[model samples]
Target: MKTSNRSCPPCRSWASRRTSRTRFSEFSPQEARNERLLTALTIDQALDARDAFAKALYSSLFAWLVARINHIVYKGSKRTSAISILDIFGFEDFKENSFEQLCINYANEHLQCYFNMHIFKLEQQEYAKEKIPWQNITYTDNQPIIHLLSKKPVGILHLLDDESNFPRATDFSFLEKCHYNHALNELYSRPRLNGPEFGVRHFAGQVWYNVEGFLDKNRDTLRTDVVDLLISSSIPVRYL
Candidate 1:
C-alpha cells in the first residue's frame, strides 16, 4: 500500500523535498487570484483597470485548468483500494480563540458524525453475521465519545447548519466537550486486536484510524491544528 500526504500552499512551500509523484489539490479561488497577480507582476504590468480585467480573466482560466484536471482524476481513477485522509486546521484551547478555531471546530464536529456512522455500520455488519440483536444494541454502547459528538439534533451537523437555532460556537463547544471529556485511555475498554473484535476485523480493512498527540488537561484544550489537518487531509484520525 502507498500513502501520500497533501498540504496547503503555506505548508507545502516549507516542506522538505522528497522524491515522489507530486499531486497538487485544486487551488481555491483566492489562491488562483494571487497566482495571477504574481504572474502579471513578473510581466512588468502595472495594476490598473485593464490589468485587473486581464488578471481576472487569466485567473479564471487558471482555475478552470486546475478544475479540469481535478475532474479528470476524479473520473478516471479506478483504484479499488484507496483511502482518503482529511487534515483540516486543528482545534484550540479557550486561550486560543479565533475564527480559524471556530471553522476548525465546526468542521471536526461534522467529521465526528461521519465517524460515528462508520463505527455503527461496521458494528451492524458484524452483528449481522453473528446473529446478534443489532437493533437492541445501544449506539452509545461502545463508542461513547463518538456517540456524544453525534448526539441528537444537537450533534455537530445540526450545529453547523447556520439555519439551526444554536449558535456556531455553542455547537462547537458541545461537540468539543465530547471530544475532550475523556482521557485517551478509554480505547482499552473495547477489544482491539482479538476475540469479538475480530468479527468486524475483515470489514475494517479499508478504513482504519491512527491517532497521536495529547491534549493539555491542565489547560483544558487541544492542539487541534495538526490533528485537524490530518483529519482534513484524507488521513483519518477521528478517534483521537
Candidate 2:
C-alpha cells in the first residue's frame, strides 16, 4: 500500500508566530464582528481546540491503519479463518466524571451491545438459517439505553448540543432539560439535592456526571481570527 503526503501552506503572520496578547477592546468594530462570527475564543480555548483536533486526527489515522492492514492481509489469504484483537478504553469512574467520561462509557456500552448481538442474536439467526433446533438463550439487550444516548432529536448528546448553542444556557438548565425529557427513562436519574448532576445506568455500571462545564466543553468553536493568524504565521502547525 502507498501513502500520500500533502504539503501545507507555511504560516507567515505575526499573530500566528507569537503568543497572542491582543486585547478584545483593541479590536476594530469590523474585527470584533469577525471575532463574533468565529465565536471569539480565548487563548486557552484555542489551545484546547488544537489539542482536541490533534487527538481526533491521530485516532482517525489509527483506525485507517488498522483497516488498511486488515485489507492487505485478507486480500490474498488462502484460509478464510482469522483472529483479530481489539483494545479499547474501559469504562471510567472518577470523583467527578464529565463529558469525556460519559462519551467513553457510552462507547463501552455500544461495544457490549455489539458483542451481545453477535453472541446471542446472531447465533439464533444462524440456527434458524441452518434449520437446526436449539434453545434460545436470554440475554440483556441494551437497545433502550443506546437509544437514550443516540436517538435523534431527543438523545442526550443532541440535547447537550442544543443547550450549548444558547448564550444564556447553564449547566442547571441542561440538567433540567435532561430530567424533563427523560424523566421516565429507567437509565436516567437526578439526585434531589445534588447540584447540577445526572446519572446514567450504563451496561457496565451506573455513573454520575457533573454538568458544571458540559456546555462549555461542547462549545468547540475556533475563532476565525485565530485560524487566520495561525495560517499566516511561520509556526509549524499548518493545516493541509
Candidate 3:
C-alpha cells in the first residue's frame, strides 16, 4: 500500500526503523549524527536531505513488501515449473538527469549484461561444446560499462561514497574526479569542456547526468536536532 501524505508521519518512525535494523545507519539521527558533524550544510540542504531520506524509506519498504508477497505467492512451486520475475526500473533518460537517473541506468546496464551472457555468450558456448554448426551472434558486452560504474577502488560508486562522507567534497569535485578517473574509458565521456556534466553510454542510449546534489543524495541523512525532537514525540505506529 502507498503511504498517505495527509498526516505527518512519526518523524521518529524512520529513527525507530534505523534503530532496529543494524544496517542503514543513515536512517536514525542519534546514530547518524556524528557522520556529518564536521560538514557544513545549510538549513535548506538539510531539509532537502530529510525529504530524500523519507522517500528512500518508502521505496525500501515497498520493495520489501513486494519481496515478502512474492515469497508467499511462489512458495513450494515445482522446480521444473518455477519461474523468476526480474522486476526492475526501465532505462531512464531525461534532459537533466541526476544521481537517481544514474542509478537506474546503472541497474539497466547490469540487466543488459545478464541478457547478453545468457542469450549470446552462454548459448554460443553450448553450441560449440556440442559441435553444432551455427552462425555466431555478437552482442554488446556491458562488462566495461559495469566496470566503469562499479569497479572496486576507483569506480564511480566508490568515489561517490567516499565523497559523500568527506567534508570538503562537492558535486563539482565529484564530477571532476569522475572525469579524471574515467576520461579514457569508452563507455564514459565528458559532455562539455566545463560544468558538472558527464555522459554515459548505456545499452539503450547515452545519458548526460548533472552532478548537482549528487553528493548529498548519496549521503542520505536527516538533521540530528530534528531527529532528537522526533524521537521524543508520540506516534501511532513505528515500523522497524
Candidate 4:
C-alpha cells in the first residue's frame, strides 16, 4: 500500500509560488499564459502517466481473476481433484514472421523436449530401476536446438539483446551476427539468395523466421520519461 509522494517538479514549484486565489479570474493575463505554457510542456508527461495507469488497471484486473480462480479450485473443505487444461497456439510460420514467432516456436520446442524427457528418458530410467526388462526406444532429442537458442554468449536471443544495445544496430546487423556465430551449428541455417531471414531446424520441423524488426521487437525497453512520470503521478497504483 506504500505510494510514491513524488510530484512533477515544475508543477510543484509553480503551485507553491502561486497566490491563494480561489478563482482563475484573479490571476493576471501573463500568469494565465504561463500556466498554459507549463501545461503544454507537460503533455508528454501526462500521456506517460495515462499509460502507466492503464497498465496498473489491467494488472489489477488479471490479479483479481487469478485470485477468484484459485479460491474456487482450492478453498473447499473436502478434498477434490480437478483438471486444468492449457491451450497454446500451434507453431506459427507466417510470410513475415518476426521475434514473436521465434519466441512461440522456442517455447514449443521446450515443451517438446519436456515431453520427450518424461515419456522416454524418465520412463526408461524407472523401468531399469524396477528391474523390468524392456527394449530401448529411440526418440529425437531437441537439446541442440534449445542450446542454440539459449546458449550463454552465442545464443540467438543473447546475440539479439547484445546487438540491440548498440546505438546503430539494425536487423541486418543482428542477422549477420547470428549467421557468423551459428554458422558452424547444424541446426542453424541461412537461406541462399533469400532476403534477411534464418532458419532453425526444430525437433518437429524446420521454421524460417524473418529477421526484420528482430532487434527492435526484442529490445523491450520502457522509456525513462515514462518511468519518471509514473513515479511522479498522484495515483497510488502507479507506484506499484
Give each model a TM-score.
0.27, 0.71, 0.71, 0.65
Candidate 2, residues 123-195: lDDT per residue as tens digits? Answer: 8999999999999899999988888887989899889989999999998898899999999999998876867
Question: 1 or 4: which has the higher TM-score?
Answer: 4
Estimate candidate 1's alpha-carbon lDDT, on a 0 to 1 scale.
0.34
TM-score for candidate 1, residues paired by index:
0.27
In order of lDDT, best first, we have 3, 2, 4, 1
The root-mean-square deviation over C-alpha atoms between each candidate and the true structure, in angstroms, is 18.2, 6.5, 7.8, 10.5
Error of 2 at 12 (Å): 16
* Residues 67-109, model 1: lDDT tens digits: 5456556666553323344676443434323333433454554
Over the full model, what C-alpha lDDT does candidate 2 score relative to the true structure? 0.72
- Model 4 per-residue lDDT tens digits across residues 42-124: 44434444454455556654555555466578866754333365756588877777888899988988888888999999999
Question: What is the Å distance of residue 152 in model 4 from its true position?
Answer: 1.0
lDDT of 1 at 110: 55
Which residue window of length 10 is worst by lDDT in model 1?
Answer: 197-206
lDDT of 3 by residue, 62-100 (tens): 555555566667656632322366687788998889999
Q: Is candidate 2 or candidate 4 better by TM-score?
A: 2
Clashing pairs in 3: none
